[model samples]
Target: MSRLWSPHIESMKREQIEEMQTELLKKQLNYVYHRAPFYQKLYKKSGVKPDDVKNINDLQKLPLTKTGDLQAEMKETGDEYSGRLCVPESELLAVYGPNQHPMPENPLITGITDSDRNTIIQHLARNLIMSGIYSGDTIQSLCWAWEPFNRVYMAANLLISPSVSEILGITPVTLEIIPLEAPRTFATARLLKPSLIIADIGHLTQLAAICQQNNISPEEIGYKTIILKEQRILSEKETKEVSEKWKAKVHNMLAVQDNMLYAEDCNIHNGLHIWEDAFIPEIVDEETGEKVGEGEAGKLAITNLFAKGNPMIRYLINITAKIEKTPCNCGRTHSRLKPQ
Candidate 1:
């Protein structure tokens, strides 16, 4: 069997997470300063040396690497858009250049050619496996993989791998991934009748309706549990109808492209266990870029400590969530995240 993080840096406690991030953050900055010429030039012009980024508090000194900056780099330079690439072109595993932009000098530069994004996923996947999810079970999704949101794909890879790690409870690590798209009723009935369905209730409703129209029994689909993505609002009628139809309990998980899904505890209605072990979370005022107090809702900015392929430090994700005050009843001291 393989392993998650060798010694496993995936499921470290909150305290350990902070200490580890602090160290990695420093190394990341130093790396960018030395390797990425673009960032090195910026540092020279700003009179802000990379060493000046002493800690998370001083991160503000480094200008936020916005999409526009990335664009400017791609337009100006060729394959080496962010001359601040710490790893060499050969070492760069993948780049996640959103389709919103024009074609890069080289397509690969924009994609995660290096393992930076992979490293981040390893941390999150290990956490997901440890949180819940056994090897014997199966996972299904309506989402696409490796294109837009590679996190889901990365997660699937982590689960299906046979590895030994303290991060995830999955020792043997063998699972199946069934990607479901439109005309899903026919597709699912024919193929992925999985035990675990990772989609929202609305998605489930759509699936059920499709199945009913096709004359397939809902039970035949076999969804023992469903991972619910947080909804904007819930109607009483909708809630009641959902409860009676499926035999599974719905779990609302907090996930976003910018902020990887995590919470304060394994089970907390409001707070999502923050993956501090990989993602360094900061709740700041939307306009002012100032930190908000605990239990307050503010803009969410995440610094992926492990992402070397494509690193984002304090990149504004445009989410406002509150930090839960009390430690989760689940008995972990790590802080939790709840949407504002």
Candidate 2:
């Protein structure tokens, strides 16, 4: 089953994406400049105002913020994001964190307040739906190196609603190993021979080896959709070699737990298709803090419109990407993402 929005998003052209960004730029700027103190101070110092910023190009008037700014705020105020939270902490949802850097260094958390938790759950549920995953689809698991973590909880909750409560602390080993007799819990899905195998690329290679050594072809074992991260468990060169060696085109996806949602697909092998409606994204030189010209490589910065809990403007996401003015081969007007 093909995803409903994939075709539309993947085919979107460049002007369309920019047009969408222009439409939302004002609201996004306002959400941050007025509500976020950090942004307000920066805007004031730079002599930029949210109302004066009309289009995406006008964004250059604003100053760029780095992770150090956030660290500084946290060190001084003990709250990390002093100007970020437009709403009370009680209204926030879960914070997703500690992915880019080590757990000790870069940490992030989301606030779960009111129905936002339910909203996030439903949003992810829809995303899985868009990705062609569904209930009763046998799912083999990975990405669980740690217990009592958020990813495990999120995967389970997004896929299984009622029993999401039960998915906590489930061992990754237990999920990887098959049972001889009838298995209960998610074990049943595995025993039933799942339709999907969710593992990083390296794990997939290892699992393929294990199955082959055991004289099992993926077809014989009912292995169908294997979700491997497009980036890689091995080096990029090695991953490409494996793809050629196996004659497989491993699908790539953008899975941001917070700050962004996986609502769009990629075109032209850029990164994920960002929801320009959800965020106003800018690319700039990490060292120089100046805008990188279109198709030029730079760090990825984000200013989200709906983020009331943490109203960050020009928040440095530490990503390097290039802009494309050309339309994608797919066919729509949305600018596709390309991440390095």
lDDT (CA) per prediction: 0.53, 0.51
Off by over 4 Å in 1: 1-15, 41-46, 76-84, 99-110, 113-118, 148-180, 184-192, 200-205, 215-220, 228-247, 252-265
lDDT of 2 by residue, 9-48 (tens): 4344556656777776777677666666777777788787
- For residue 317, model 2's alpha carbon misses the true position, in angstroms, by 2.7
lDDT (10s digit) by residue, model 1, range 310-330: 556666665667676355554
TM-score of each: 0.71, 0.70
Compared with the true structure, the alpha-carbon lDDT of candidate 1 equals 0.53
Q: RMSD in angstroms, all models? A: 6.0, 6.2
